[model samples]
Target: MDSPFTSKLGTNYCPTAEDAVEIQAFLAQPLRQMECLDRKIAELQHALNKLLEEREGLGSIVQSHEALLSPIRRMPADMMQEIFLACLPTHRNCVMDAREAPLLLGRICSAWRALSLATPRLWASLHIVDRGEPPQRTGCGRCPSMARTGWSVPTIPFAAI
Candidate 1:
């Protein structure tokens, strides 16, 4: 919606230096009238803030309902598991890095974590190149043992633990 405090400047809106001078003169031409405009401006600002809060609330409600309509919510668990399995590296092995796909799958949602962990195929192929175990809290929050024991197959840590 257009702002309630519609600018006095018209649709044409081409102000010259003379126009600026004239406008300043007009604003001060009436004593205490600027104070009235200020009050109106404050009132409009309050109304705008309230509208913004209301819009945020309305958006949240819409967001809450959006989950129910998602096709992902309706997909069969078996189908999702198949999809998750396909996401794993076929020729090479998967790194334990949280940034990559198979590992990243678990962190996305509880259902995904369960599937990724349960599917033995997802863990069957892994090729890790650990720069080094990250120091505690350096980043990525409590890093997992990546390529530990010289990358002799992680043995499906997600499934095991």
Candidate 2:
């Protein structure tokens, strides 16, 4: 019997059994490609979700740090001074880095830098020790001599020394 589906060239387009198999195989290629694309989309969605979650966690941490910093900014000047004084090292070390003090204090903010600079006693204590032979007896470590003048004082505040 002649198939209804026919090309202008008179070929039977309503496939025979063998032809049906080939047609099904050809159709399966697109299905397989679609499945692969679906899997990739799902993986991308999971990755995006994970990144969003991480961003939220980091945002919360930033907010917490900002909240913590706000109180320090609002602190009374006199009280802040006391806190800065209390934060000073009790012992002076000859091998100290003047850079270290400002660096640590600067971690807070500009106000901290000003406060630390204003406190002369905070930089006054110098206790340089020479476990080995003193290099020159005139200078400490890599710190500049100008910064070391505070240490030259015979005695600093007892709390500071």
Candidate 3:
């Protein structure tokens, strides 16, 4: 596979017509080999892309099935309600902020929202801060009216408390 041009490479020597013909013949085999390599590389790249797509599809399936086995989804409603109740502040009444529980519990999922709202005890006590603004009486439809005297006077039933 040696070329007559090999010894003459990197020199200013001009090739004769016969030397030029020999150089072209010498290059043919390597050029065909390079073309074969390029085709193989393209085929391997297509196979790699297909494998990556299959892996991504399998990952999505695994994630969805994993959600079905979550412990929270299996817990009984009564137990979940107790956990929600425990999240309430013991030192003081629950605040209207979403950062705290009761309100935070309602934001978790639809089932929890229904349970938290259905549980009247969770909305039993609310510490209202009068920031010189009129109070908004928007709680579980059972929220008593706020007296218009700039004071939050909740007349919640004793049973709800």
The best-first sequence of candidates by TM-score reads: 1, 3, 2
| Local accuracy by lDDT, each model | 0.68, 0.61, 0.74
**Weakest ten-residue segment in model 1 by summed lDDT:** 142-151
Q: Please write out the lDDT profile of model 3 over residues 1-161, one tens digit for every residue.
A: 77767789899999999988988888999999999999999999999999999999999999999999999999998888788889988887766688897778888889898888766667666665544433355343423213211333432322212
Q: List the residue pairs that clash in candidate 1.
A: 93-126, 93-127, 94-126, 94-127
RMSD for each model, in Å, please?
Answer: 11.0, 11.5, 7.9
The prediction achieving the highest TM-score against the true structure is 1
lDDT of 1 by residue, 113-136 (tens): 876767666665555343455545
- Per-candidate clashes come to 4, 4, 0
Highest lDDT against the true fold, candidate: 3
For model 3, the stretches where C-alpha displacement exceeds 4 angstroms are 1-39, 134-161
Question: Per-candidate TM vs. native?
Answer: 0.61, 0.45, 0.59
Look at candidate 3 and give me any clashing residue pairs. Answer: none
The candidate with the higher TM-score, 1 or 3, is 1
Evaluate model 2: give its TM-score.
0.45
